[model samples]
Target: MNKIETVKIPRHVAIIMDGNGRWAQSRGLPRAMGHRKGVEAVREAVRVAGDTGVGFLTLFAFSSENWTRPETEVNDLMGLLKAFIRRDLAELHGENVRIRIIGARDNLRGDILPLLIEAEETTKANTGLTLVIAFNYGARDEIARAARKLAEQVAAGVLRPDQIDAVALDAQLDTQGIPDPDLVIRTSGEERLSNFLLWQAAYAELLFVPEYWPDFTRDVFYRALAVYAGRERRYGGIAAAAVTG
Candidate 1:
């Protein structure tokens, strides 16, 4: 196992939590059981992130396409979400963790929207780790929404078309003020982004782990961090060693 180098800790870490249903099915248990266990992993991840001094932790809790799942399963997921916020919001806020929700808020269920809002409001004054929850979020949709905002400004004659560059669009994004992720880890060995944070992850170091979401532990997280520390991020430029050589 690689030792995590504290000096190289990533400022932002985003995770695509996957394979909950498979984790339960492999053990001959119901899929819902897997999701419940995944919640435990979420708690561990948050604690570990805080301890590791990761300034931002973005969790892909739910995507917009998840609504296509069976109604019963969707209900189960919703119930778990409500239960998690109700049970853990105070504890998270007390820990000085600032909660931020990023995603489309239009047409969310009445009960769920209020809980998300309350969580953010309650933790707005926190100064510790920023816990970002991507709920009902899709990168493509996010980009489109941002574009529409810019278009609206142009149509209103408040902004010119030429002024709509990346910076202007970025300010309209849900993650406007947040830094881009330095590391993106996906459990269950999945390598794809699945429409999560496509724009913000332009230069993130990607890691795909074999462990399922329910089985993801603190050790695994640390190992991922160690791997990230070993990497040399050059963005679009060449490495210094190569240039010097």
Candidate 2:
């Protein structure tokens, strides 16, 4: 079946796109090929989400620890990202997708930062979907940054000590305007968060698919949605209606 079969879409879905290097290695490629193919998967996934009317889609593009990789690979990845934004920005705007990059902007490569800003500005008013790309982003670091900013405000007497609470912290997060994900899918059979969306994913349904990111096409996305349909999300409490369907 095609990607459109994935009905009952979640409001927000986060994906941990893993296994690019491993997939490439098995094919005797230099890993860059895998990354390139994974880019195709991103497009397909976007189409499927758009078709299914998913409000928000966040892809774990690059993590804070990804900086530890060799310079060659990092450069290659950055180039691919730049190329993607340049080539896909217009198409994304045409499709009514608001392109947003959420991460430590200061840590990003200079060339990419400007392109990201332009893309965000170019698509800010789109209403179809919100695609959040996490580059140089870490949940721990985000929390720390929020805390640091709040502390500074308190020290300056601009904020009261008793006013700092979960609500206040939530509003300070990078994903302040975004809703918590209803489901999080990790490809390549990895189920762990790897420091993704710590505070936001407290009640998200986790699904680990054995397929690699490149292989995670429209069909797999539909299957995940079907699986999610069978679940009864409790969100830290019991269902009120005896939830037996």
Candidate 3:
């Protein structure tokens, strides 16, 4: 049995699912196959997070930079995303999970936008684990969009410049009501954020594992949770003794 039950489980966990192409290349298979396998890992992660009492799980599914990839691969990914939603939506709803998406939708294709809306509408009131899918999401873009919104308000005299602070900006962000991530995990030995959740992860504990995302298993997730549970998060202020000195 896993020892994670003995430690504190994170209320929110975000993941950068990296290395699908590499995993496929290493196995002499097509990259698409790797992505398909990665979908399985996504299912497992959701199950584990739900079972372990995690309230929120945010996944970096796709990024704005991904548009520069090959067109065929992009289409394949979009197809996979649609399939995942259509196939898994019912099961997720049955499990009392709420689906939420973060990212820009203004320019999304007509077909894609509805699917995303359907997922949210279908699970709006589940009152269970909330799955946040960051599709076409970039941290910088999210921040910039928020800034633009605030700038417009300031320009229109609806708000003063001085009133625009972290709190005001956060309300404009895609993750306004969601709590910040307690832990951010990156697979495939990557130590960088890759623009996953920059502002929200300001004080998050990071864990980088060597396993490719497609190979990410329940064990790996439990181990990462264990590591997070062992850490001392001071959030800037030190102990009372250290502060006095």
lDDT by residue for model 3 over 55-88, one digit each (tens)?
Answer: 9999999998998999999999999999999999
Per-prediction TM-score, please? 0.98, 0.96, 0.96
Question: Tens-digit lDDT track for model 1 on 186-242?
Answer: 999888999999999999999999999998998999999989989999999999899
Model 2 regions more than 4 Å off:
3-7, 240-245
Ranking by TM-score: 1, 3, 2
The clash number for model 2 is 0
Which model, 1 or 2, shows the larger TM-score?
Answer: 1
> How big is the positional error of residue 71 in model 3, measured in Å on the Cα after superposition?
0.7
lDDT of 2 by residue, 1-245 (tens): 85545456799999999999989998999999999999999998888888888899999999999989999999989989999999999999999999878788876657888998999999999998999998889999999999998999999999998999999998888898999999999999887999999999999999999999999988899899889887878878878677554
Candidate 2, run of 10 with poorest lDDT: 1-10
TM-score of model number 1: 0.98
Listing every candidate in turn, what is its Cα RMSD in Å to the true structure after a full C-alpha superposition? 1.3, 1.7, 1.5
